[model samples]
Target: MREIAVVFVLLAFLAHSAMGEEMVFFADDLYKAAATPELHASLVDPAVAPGGSTALKIVVANSGRVLALLPTGIQGSSLEASREMQEELRSVDALNVVATLTAKDPVSVLSGPATIPLLPSGTAQPVEFLVQVGEGAEGPYHLDLRLDYEHQIDVRISAGQASPLYVPANVSEEITIHAGGSRESFRADYARSELWPGENGTLTLVIRNLAGPAGNCSARLLAAPPFRASDQPVSLGYMQPGDLALATFWVEVGDNASVRQYQMACQVLQDGESSAWSSTIPLTVAVEEGQSIQIWLVPLPLILALAFLAWRWWQG
Candidate 1:
């Protein structure tokens, strides 16, 4: 009985060792099954101008190689092994992919996150995002592209086995775009800066083209409350770089306008494109109170009339 008990203890120890070895082998197989999908992205058009709206085209692809090995120590038929291997290869495909783009100040992403239902291995898909650049933006800017998706890692083909492991992947990439430097296209100055309430006057704006040449350039007054432009847009004709021109508008001030400095703007249009205004130049003007009649002057007129009547009566 003692010998039998000792033999039983030895058998149990060997069984434990065998189980440990199997686990180690299974862990190694899982490591071998681990694969990462390769993705590359870039902007379709890398050059952009400040104060402009554009689209960013991102192309995503999966270039991961499929694994050709089965889990270790599994005694399955060739057909079963083939099926499992196929499933493992399919795991290289990215599923439920989501992409997000982020930008810093002066650059804004107008569109929301882009989505992809499936990205099969060795396949590429294109996604677009609308971007708006501020007027002050200049030089090269870096935009962040983030990709999130689920990818299958391993498949279990036994009863009560856990479902295929779908691992979440996060990829961060940087995209560079060159933005043209911003320059003052035009400078504006007012010819007359003061007007009285209930007054009609001609307002002149001296516009100097500081940047590029423009043709059919015109300027219109953006008169708000308390001011109105009676004339249409005034033409400045063709202007070369560094050229100066004048635009005049017949303006009427409201009677109830306040006696203070009022802010105004001038809209400059080029090439008869009324829908697209090149720039808005800010302006400032002051409204003064009208002069009142003096009390002495009013009495002098009445005294003169009375004096003339007395002289006529005495002469009669």
Candidate 2:
């Protein structure tokens, strides 16, 4: 009887030792590396501009150990041997996986904390984070992620003889982020505040390049109600950073235009690319009503009579 009891204890000890081994395998292709610490993450991209969102793929693996003992000669049964100690694995409860994001200097965290329900030895899970950058944020930025979870591991050595072990997992990863630099926008103003009807005038605009990498700039004027631009689209060539270029547009006021101010719109494009629209500005031009036609006609007949008399004298 003593020998049999010792034998049973030895078998239980061997089984416990075999079940304690666990290996975690992460997909290398899916891992994103950060610039600072040489660690692996789910995502680290520089293409994220101001007010953008990015997703991270967080996966947990148990190394294909989901089964119990199988025939030795059968292929792919070695991992199944661990299942002998975990027959109640399928009946175990689920776990809550929580993730949070934090951005370093120059980068602001808009919104984040994507959570999911994960199971042991299950498929990969994904989390997302939203961030925004400041206009003056000319920086090399990065993000830090914190992952926390509560998992309940099940171990069953025999029928109706199972024990539950609760474990908490926490991990941290860093990701890189980026944003665009500031640039000076184009602005336009009228040369004169007011003009008479049927009068031709010029409008002046200043294109400022201030720290932006834009070239081949051009602008088009859009007018409405009694205002017409002689040059619809004016071309203003390249301007280097900290340099300003002057643009002028010839415009005319309609003869019958009202004496009120009319609003005009201007659209700018860069690099001679029609598909891209740089900026839109508003301009105001005022037209004053002209004198009555009768006032001007009073001298027209006198001038004609003088001309006729001159022609009669020549004939004489």
Candidate 3:
């Protein structure tokens, strides 16, 4: 009986060891490194501008036994012509802000100090960051991002602290890239405010009409870290003389929604008839759990009737 008990215990230990074996993970990254051309050359880049906000983004993948940690830091930067535009870029609310992790796959990601977390044992999750450039120094300036990471150790780790990266880190620094500076006029208009959750919240627009018809238009939503369209042409449709046709479409936010205001837009047709739109109407989502929120526009139908009555009395 004693010998049998010892044999059972040994088998249980072996089974647990087998289950704890580490699994290898892998992912491929197609990256573009930034470079500088001769100062005299003109390159067209719609990303960097003087007075507007252009986003800088990069993707990262990790495979390890524990969550990956990329430290807080800057990666790279490009120059922009036009001092006026530069001032606007630098002056925006989040301008000159330090780098922090903005997004991650498997979703529900947020910023953290020191290091950002990466997934383990799977090549499917990709991490992304949104760097907002508010008012920043003139072009020809070097921007830096500190890359740091942490991982869980087999031993105990203290609260609010982390172990060093378990996997090797390979982030490309300065590859090779150039930039351009050309002014393109832009305009965006809203239809009204108020939208339904998981429904299409639409907007209209008129851009570069006076600047010579319209060019490329786009739609953007600033929920938090800033999420804009990645593969969409949020542009306007066609129109007839004196007839303002549609310009942009709304994002279907699906069934899950919360109380929030959204901005929206559309654009005039010309030069690609491009369009720009806000993510939401200024209207609140007015959603509640286990209940429905209804929002309707209250129109004053009697205003026109009262105006006609007053006109008749004045004529008499």
How many steric overlaps are in each model, in order?
A: 0, 4, 39
Local distance difference test, per candidate?
0.60, 0.45, 0.28
lDDT of 1 by residue, 246-289 (tens): 98888787554433344444556678654233333333445544
User: Model 3, residue 219: what's the lDDT?
Assistant: 34
lDDT of 3 by residue, 39-101 (tens): 000011213333344433332222122111111112212221122122211111111112233
Using all chains and alpha carbons, the TM-scores for the candidates as numbered come to 0.46, 0.35, 0.28
Name the candidate that leads on TM-score: 1
lDDT score at residue 314, model 2, on the 0-100 scale: 54
lDDT of 2: 0.45
Give the number of the best model, judged by lDDT: 1
Rank list by lDDT:
1, 2, 3
Q: Residue 221 in candidate 2 has what lDDT?
A: 53
Better of 1 and 3 by lDDT: 1
Which residue pairs collide in model 2, if any? 67-80, 67-83, 68-80, 68-84
Candidate 1 runs further than 4 Å off: 1-32, 67-71, 158-163, 181-316
lDDT for residue 297 in candidate 2, whole number 0-100: 15
